[model samples]
Target: MSQYWELLASRSDDQHTSEELEMTAYRLAVEQVLYYADRHSRTAYWMIERYEREFRQALVPLGIDVQVNRQLRYAYALPKHAKAGTASIAQTVFALVLRAIYDEAASIGQLTEGGEVLCDLVELAEKYRLMSGKELPTKGKLDSLMETMKRWGIAKKSEDHGLDDGEDMAGQPYAVVIRPAIADVLGEAALARLVQFKAVASANDEPEAVTSVAEEGESQE
Candidate 1:
């Protein structure tokens, strides 16, 4: 854990009256990065943008690599030697599907200004069915996956937006708020790979064709 004070001391040309305030801001930025590995909350993001240089500089001494996307208004930290992804295969696939859904929805203007989108459980069930060619998971399993997504800063139950998590929503519509952080987690590179993999898989899964009598004669020749 690198102390922000240490970094500030090393870089401060005018270490006057605002050192303590700046230190507090730097520490808060670090905590924000730790809590939200994808993208910090809006308030935290603004603060991070204001102190982006300090945040990056502080993490360097501690052996942590950080990525700041100014266009997307987000920042995240990477451990010195972090693994590629933090989610299980199922979780990762589900998240990728949500991202695809988000992109599709946004194309037709279904997303809000904050890049937040609402996706119903019924819609998700249909997507899962299509993706796996099987029935949707049990409510318990679905709920568990959603909880894991929430922890990962992917999606969350938005009761304020008329979303619910009870059995009452089984037949009706039940939605989750897909957070903007999902874009940072599953960026363009990963999505492109997924598309390529899907195309290859689809081609491989096609049924084989049988040759007729004329074709057999040609093969014999």
Candidate 2:
């Protein structure tokens, strides 16, 4: 495993050098996710695709599971026993709503070529309230919470989506552009949890149950 890169590098001139692969491996470890549709990560994503097997083998000892979503054209690494990170309950609900929205878009074949989905803030608030039986945070607080989603590689801001002009976020209708990564981050299991949580909320359950679900279903790597 130590010489995995070298072994692959030795294969052919077409094979990238050990140092190049090593650097990519390090980046993947640090970043945890890459998408072919992301310009900054395009090369790195291709590199991983090229050496998927070696990368998987090399990462096994580190308890890192590498998964590639072929349809979505993205790769992500999951750390053993880790949720993307510790997320606040608000963020957990936000992710759930985003995931549900993404599913709706995907089902209708409305996903962009990059597998991104557009979500208006108004719709987001509506869905958030519907799902959690709580109001979405104010714009200011939402900004802070959204950083968590960005860090988890599940969502991107409009500016990041190549918005025209130097349009100010405050001057326009805010939107949450969800990345394809959300599909993997919060899968069908998340939707199931939503049904479960909705029932709990309807029953006027204690905070602990909902809180526990949020903590457990936090975004994935």
List model 2 lDDT by residue over 62-177, tens digit each. 77767787777888776665544355445666777888889888899998877888877777888877877777788777898677787778887776666553343446555788
Q: What's the distance in Å from true for residue 220, model 1? A: 48
Each candidate's lDDT (Cα)? 0.55, 0.71
Of the candidates shown, which would achieve the greatest lDDT relative to the real structure?
2
lDDT of 1 by residue, 15-63 (tens): 4224553544555434323222233355555545656676667667666
Model 2 poorest 10 in a row by lDDT? 205-214
The lDDT, on a scale of 0 to 1, for candidate 1 is: 0.55
- Model 2 misplaced regions, further than 4 Å: 12-15, 83-85, 165-173, 195-221
Evaluate candidate 1 by giving its C-alpha RMSD to the native, one decimal: 12.8
Clashing residue pair totals per candidate (backbone < 3 A) = 0, 0
Q: What's the TM-score of every candidate structure?
A: 0.60, 0.79
